[model samples]
Target: MAATAPKSLGAGEGAGNIGFDRSGIAGESKGLLKVLDTARKVAKSDSSVLITGESGTGKELIARAIHRNSTRRNGPMVIINCGAIPSELLESELFGHEKGAFTGAHRSRTGRFEIADNGSLFLDEIGDMSSDLQVKLLRAIQERKFERVGGTQTIAVDIRVISATNKDLAAAIKEGEFREDLYYRLNVIPIHILPLRERRDDIFPLTDYFQNNLLDRSTDYQIKQFSDQAKQVLTHYEWPGNIRELENMVERISVLVEEVDIQVHDLPECMITPSSHHTSSSVSSVFNNGIGFNEAVDQYQRSLISHALNESGWVKARAAEMLKMNRTTLVEKLKKMHIKPEMETPIF
Candidate 1:
């Protein structure tokens, strides 16, 4: 028989919930909205969920949301970064170890499954796991039972599994890198997170949300407006790094551009340049003879400013010092280059 569903499922309460707000998942994209709705419905059931997305697309967050909205919200939610742990150590980490199980096993350990009993176990970057581990994981999921290293007693687990991966598991299976049976077991309920680029509508609201949230923390700047030109530039730039990149950019601009209202000229050079899609030919020609000296310098300056902003975590004064430029001079350059510190809400 299937495991019993936890009471209060879909009510969004408990430690396993991780405070994942439904609003965070809401987006302008119809596809995303549909996905969120489906996720919500699935959360009501006790089914394993497999989230697939690009590296920075917030798969973990979605998993948390699912767990929070699920019946097991009150239980512990354990997260295991499969890629971060070495293959040699992964088995012990997931299955725990008994005293004297192997070298340095002085005491018994409770694995992630045991810790997350009756809750959720998020296996992040599952694509990076080895085939041996995959077989172990598959057996554990099928029987909900595992044995600790060097221990004969069978330990039963009552936890839901949520696995995430950026890599194409089908391709990995074809390449003999991943187990096909494990893939089928994990793919019972699949949810694909749309990248920020695909859901442009969320950009502006997310920017505003981050800005307002930052300001609440007593940031230096009191200004909270973006110029029309600045908005255009932001919308045009192809955000390869997705929402995380956009968030970083907004925080940088918020602290750097001091004006009550940000304008187009306050944008970074990369935003204004026609070459959002920089070709190798363009890069080579632009720097080969050091020709277009002005443009190259502008690019360098923009990069310097961007890097400073990122390094300083979007604090303008710190970024200014890092850039080795006077605060006033930095502000002037920003204006001249049409680099706006404030980004408009992205419309999907």
Candidate 2:
């Protein structure tokens, strides 16, 4: 059953108590807030949940949040990466095996399902689960009971199932790679997390969170401020790796950058340089505008100068250095072009 949308909680609010501990997940963007709200509402239920998102988008983090907020908070939260384990051993990994059930079974082993009893079982990368195993998993999840590998006695357990996957299971089902029935059983409450690029509003907040949080733990690390130009670059670039990439970059800079004021040049070259897609789109717009050649060149110069000036906080000398031009020359051009901060647009 679908849950009604409730008022979204601000990031870091309603924390510490059960069903409200959103300690690690940070972001105030509407997309993220909505997801969190749904997660909170679903946490109170015992229905199965399926979380879908790109890699590094914090699907597991959401799963954990749901578990922490749920009735089973005190129970163990067992997780398994379906894609990481081999198909041959995955069944045993999920359902446990008796001694001598398989060649490697030196002794009877408890699987994730059994270990997760009375708690939450997070099946990560569920899309990658083998077709052969899908049938067994569906039955177990449906009945809340299963026989251990090579064991005749059936074992029963109470668990809340939460599965996450980066792949599109709808297409997988159409292609017969994933079972449709199993998909329905697991997707009772679907929660999709938008990628970082789609929620650009969270970038700076996350940066601040990562920077300050890291500094608290390590004496070697220090908080670094992001320059306006650097912020611009971060805002425009697509974060294919999502929150994980942002956190890593923050830590990397905190360790390596000695300057307290982080300049645009301090950022990774990939972020500073325009991607082929963006470059092509910008160039196409320029050509489509049908402006004269000289005017086009002048506009291009204005964009560059404006970008540099903004990056340098309107300091002529610094902007000139960034542009590899004399301060006098840059000032003269700015006056001639009638450029102002408000008119500045980042072409890259």
Candidate 3:
């Protein structure tokens, strides 16, 4: 079963359902909501939409949502990854070849454009499309007509185009890698999605959504809750892989973690440990300060203790367990370092 769509702030509030469906999407962040609002308005028309974002930022999801809520909802929503297919074969894939048009062509095959007649065609990773094909695509978009490869017949399609790309098309045009005219045609209605790091508020909500989906899938699956420290670590770490990465992590935790409560240690080591970039900065700070090695080590120790205490909610026993030290030793260190619960920020 597919995952249920998580609640948004105002999916259809004042709009009154003018072909707006937020199915399979899960986020309440303002950035995401603004994108959805624009999508809701655009779905009513046949305007071409170009979604730009990082690889895992769910550009395809936005495309699908628009298609589902469009006037051609009954028609098929055909998807083609321009980047995944090789340049030599992509032409035939988009505009089907006739029988014996190319090697291994046993019979005539229908292309994505023809199959998506009276519907929507999603061109994923459109930036990776070769310049030679861009000219044909531009003409097809402008006239809604194209001839199949090695065939003289011209087929017309009444299709709405939705294209998505992670690459910078503007830069590609400047570099002469992408056609400027084609870019303008595809980007009539631009929707740029912000990466996950910029929209941190959606992290926990998305995490919960993925966990709930897992619960729905199996009776033996126990929903695991992230500990406060784990959540803190998750929020602090930069998710370079975005939503896709988060979903993968949730699945990994569900399969590997037997306990219902997920601790910070249960997360990937990269999140728990200080990154090399941060460690280099720390070393630079140590040299900048007129402090000895001993003082630097003490400062690092204090930072770890403070982070552990904060993660443990200042409970001495839990904090000590996190640090793998005796409660009394942790208390003595706390007193020696003059550590207090008031220190809210983790120095590291």
Candidate 4:
């Protein structure tokens, strides 16, 4: 466990950082700090924990932190992404399978539960688990014992479970997609990580750290700095993809931009400008002119796209980000609207 979290979101202060230095979780916002505090407090206990957050918020990092700080630190910290494994094969993966358990069961293999005995199990994207598997999982957690597939002997595991999800489990329960009883069992201690936009203060510090380390390790590049304008633009932009997006952008800039200082143009258009959905006086002009509702909406979209292109140095890829749109979707819109060659030089 980290002795203390950095007081500021500067280059290298990690407060209560237990297991995330190698995983790239950098932030000092109140929201992030509070979550770390909660993680620290809960790590001392053996109860199941549920971490909820948007994609790319580093839920797995928190799970590892808990495990590292817990009494089971020396034991194996087994991890399984519930959403990544196929539903048909998930059962065998969780509980060991005996030889001839199924068509492809060539040999008896130990499963995650058995491997995680006397340790911790990190289950990511728990919400995506199918209802059928939910019942078996519930029994395993409640009873702390499960039989291997096609095997009569029961396996007992003394493991701590930490689960993460991007989905709203309550809504899933209300709709009968997830079981209510399972939800209660998994959500013993909850940690909700705020998205990057909500904790915008961490952007610059995270970028600084990611850029320095990413460049220093790269054979093709050297460390680079961000211009003040570039930093401001990044700070103002809403990072829909959160820390993962920011780290990726930093790595891209370090490798792609030759300059020692990263300029505004070096960033992806999405990070330099507000999403097109924000309030804009330029878009309001159509309505001020008393134009038809449909026509006004159409004009607004075109104008926004055009402005995004201009701001993005006529780069369609960056423009699409500035517009908060998929590149293919933007291309289709441009084709339908007849965006002129003079306005946008089409580049595949």
Candidate No. with top TM-score: 2
Worst 10 residues of 3 by lDDT: 1-10
In the range 52-127, model 2's lDDT, one tens digit per residue, is 9999998999999999888999999999999999998999999999999988788998989999999999999999
Give the per-residue lDDT digits (tens) of candidate 4, residues 1-348: 211222233322466554433234566777788888888778889999999999988798889878877889899999999999999889899997999999999999899999999999888999999999999999999888999999999889899989999999999999999999999999999999988767776787787667644444445455567665466456545567998998888877766887787776677865544455545532443333344678656655765786677777778899999888999999899899876432321110
lDDT of 3 by residue, 95-129 (tens): 89899888888899899999999999999999999
lDDT (Cα, 0-100) at 219 in candidate 1: 35
- Alpha-carbon RMSD to native, per candidate: 12.3, 8.8, 8.0, 10.2
TM-score of 2: 0.79
lDDT of 1 by residue, 235-278 (tens): 54556677777777777776677666777556665555444344
Model 2 regions lying over 4 Å from their true place: 1-19, 215-222, 279-348
Off by over 4 Å in 3: 1-19, 215-217, 277-348
- Reference-based TM-score, model 4: 0.75
Pairs that collide in candidate 2 are 19-69
Per-model CA lDDT versus the true structure: 0.73, 0.82, 0.82, 0.77
**Candidate 4 stretches greater than 4 Å from native:** 1-24, 216-222, 280-348
Clashing residue pair totals per candidate (backbone < 3 A): 17, 1, 0, 6
Error of 4 at 88 (Å): 1.3
> How does residue 316 of candidate 4 score in lDDT?
86
